[model samples]
Target: MIDLGALAKITKAFKVIDNDKSTNRLSHAYLIVCQDAENLEGYMRYFAKQLLCSESVPCESCRHCSLINSNAHQDVFFYPTSEKGILTEDINAIISESYVRPIESEKKVFVLSNAQTMNAVTQNKLLKTLEEPPKNVYILIGTTSEQAILPTVKSRVKKVEISPFSKTVLINALIDQCKDREKLENAVACSDGTLGKTLALYQDQNLKNVIDLGIEILTKMQSSKDVLEYSTKIIKNKTDLDQFFDVLDMLLRDTLVKECGDQSLITNPNALNQLQNANFKNGALISIISAVTDARKRKQFNANQNMLIEWLLFKILEEKFRWQKL
Candidate 1:
């Protein structure tokens, strides 16, 4: 059930593949970069269909399209089947199997998911196949960050960056699923043009609550004594911490925009007045934003959640006070 119409409206990644096919200049290796991990697989599948489908475009009714959609296509292979990610051994296996002919279709497509997970050694192992790919074979690598890939491997692949959906496009696609207009608007505003995040925010019943908590912290939380109280309320678990950080980041960014007298550019219109009244200095806001980013990096390395929350709050409060005196 690949919704070609919806995907076409949301992204242009497939169109790039289609154009390549129509012109008969299809690259042997393609690097698909998308920030939304949830929809990356769907993009990869569409790319595969464009290459294998007998029709000028993916008809969805063709055997190649059906097999690809169902993950039953023998000629189409997806690698790093485990959660451990792409390893040197997986690269070796791909190199070994790539020379074999396609089982059904005229072309073979090997999708390497999470290409960023392939360290220098593993990526190096993949270079030979990329350099001298078998006839009619395609290597499609999907990654969230292209910078993580080595330049040597990158130069050989045709890189396609997935664009974010426009607000109107996202609204049209999600309107049927979400009846709450206010919630839908909020989700779209906070999604940063990605459909996956918009859907997650729309379904989160606690989104409004989290946002309110973030506003309260920015406008009301004062002195070191309030840090523990806010931390307890915001950091019940890792998921809660992430949600809090996202909300806080958005609010801070909006506040900074407002402080700079650019009301039209702020994302959260509903919170504009609250942000305007917060009266945070630009220096303090910038420092707090940097602190939040540092906290997120620490969280990725298995940092203690409670300590991280407390430290982040302290930094915010200290900046608030220091900037107020100046």
Candidate 2:
């Protein structure tokens, strides 16, 4: 059966699998692309189920289905095996494991998450497997950006790209997981339409602090010393650099929406009045938002996190004050 849960946005990818299954022509290699690592792993599980199911479609009740979904299947190996990312030793282990045939299902699947973590040696080892996979062997590589992977490594696999869901789709999926409506709404507002990120941001205890910091930056714009101090305070510590920017972007977006007089579109409704009275006009807010978007794109390329975020904060400050003249 089709995995409706994970592949909703990338139905085309699912369709390829279904068609292949119908024709008994499943590709030996697949690269599942996504920005969120957690979500990419979920899709890996989904595809594993699709590959190992005994019935014409995956019956959720079957033992194989259960094992695959739980990530307990004996023949399935998840690469980079730990948070430490892929190492030469791990690659050796994977190469050693690939020789074993499936014990439970008709096929053996190797799942590589954050596949870009593989260095040249590791990837070269993997390339040997891809060049001549054994019978009933499938290798699945999960990555946020295909660019992070070497072009040679990418060439062997059929690429399946999955994008973030729309706000409506994201909120609907979150409704079951999040009970508090207000917090849920806030998460939905700040989310980049990826459930992994939405849950992460929603469950973050320091999210309020981050958001408050952004607002503080805006509110204290009249005093340069306060902005500089606030920036230093937030930047000095180790942090989830991505989430920090996500929070700042949300605050900026809310202010931008408020500037347009669209109350219904406001994500941070409680801060409507404060945002409306902020130092930026519509054009300045738009310019800052554009800069934030560009900065986010840069982050995907593995930009120096501290330098990028610090630069972005300063850019926002510059725009906020520069626009007062406009």
Candidate 3:
């Protein structure tokens, strides 16, 4: 048996759940999308536990409980792929698994994390299964909503948005996990209220260093040469490319806030003095943001990491318009 307790976020989903629970209103497939990783994972676990537990309702303790807790549930299947995101072979394997009946439990659940990584070909393959899921089968897809997953697949599944925690809540969570106050604050700001990514920064020293360096680079880019210099430094670190992208994303977001006169959103509160030093127009800021985004996407395809970063910096450097003479 599993106990399905109501947490604040869960309760919001419960209204949707309650309407369907009596009539067994659960969808054959569900897409849980959000920037918040903790809430997203919680929903997946809750859904899985409910499907497996012997008790009609969720009871956290039971035979099913043991399996899910140990991540050993035979019937509760997790989609396995080589990396953080889904691949073509992963979708194929998941489709193949769908045909098999549960080993013990009545329902077989497939939880796909980072479901947005399912490319078009994979999404097409999943469409048929999603449309006609086996009786007692549940497919749960999780991803950041910004990623453009196929609309065909999205339409077939019920969509649940998991809101990320507030910045204060996220900061407190990171604080609980980290002893270093400065690092915790930096991680909280860099993550922009995402707990999973925030935790990743805390665990990976290289990532932490990159975040620190990334801020410094953005602050120091007075000319194209400076941008290229910093990008070169980032290239040499061997830090997770995603982390670098994240830092750049935060920098742009902070710049946007500064542009909008919202000084509170500035992560580099100390750097605001310097950011104000370089007067950037909205057009220039947009250009810099686009260049960084493109560079990050290029890196995904194993594009020349150093060249791409340097090129991106060059683009920002070429934008000669200084801020309204601070």
RMSD of each: 4.0, 5.0, 6.1
Q: Candidate 1: where is the Cα deviation over 4 Å?
A: 1-5, 8-12, 54-57, 72-74, 80-105, 116-125, 145-151, 163-169, 185-193, 222-228, 235-239, 259-265, 273-276, 281-284, 297-326
Estimate, for each residue in 251-271, the C-alpha lDDT of model 1 and write its tens digit: 888788877765766667786
Model 3 TM-score on a 0 to 1 scale? 0.63
Of 1 and 3, the candidate ranking higher by TM-score: 1
How well does each candidate superpose onto the true structure, as a TM-score?
0.76, 0.73, 0.63
Residue-by-residue lDDT tens digits, candidate 3, 8-105: 23444444544555567778777777676545555567767765665645676798877886788888766534555777777777778888988877
Q: Name the lDDT of candidate 1.
A: 0.82
How far out, in Å, is residue 322 in model 1?
6.0
Task: Return the top candidate by lDDT.
Answer: 1
Q: Which candidate order results from sorting by lDDT in descending order?
A: 1, 2, 3
Q: How well does model 2 score by local distance difference test?
A: 0.74
Whole-model Cα lDDT of every candidate shown, in order:
0.82, 0.74, 0.68
Clashing pairs in 2: 1-58
- CA shift of 274, model 1, Å: 4.6
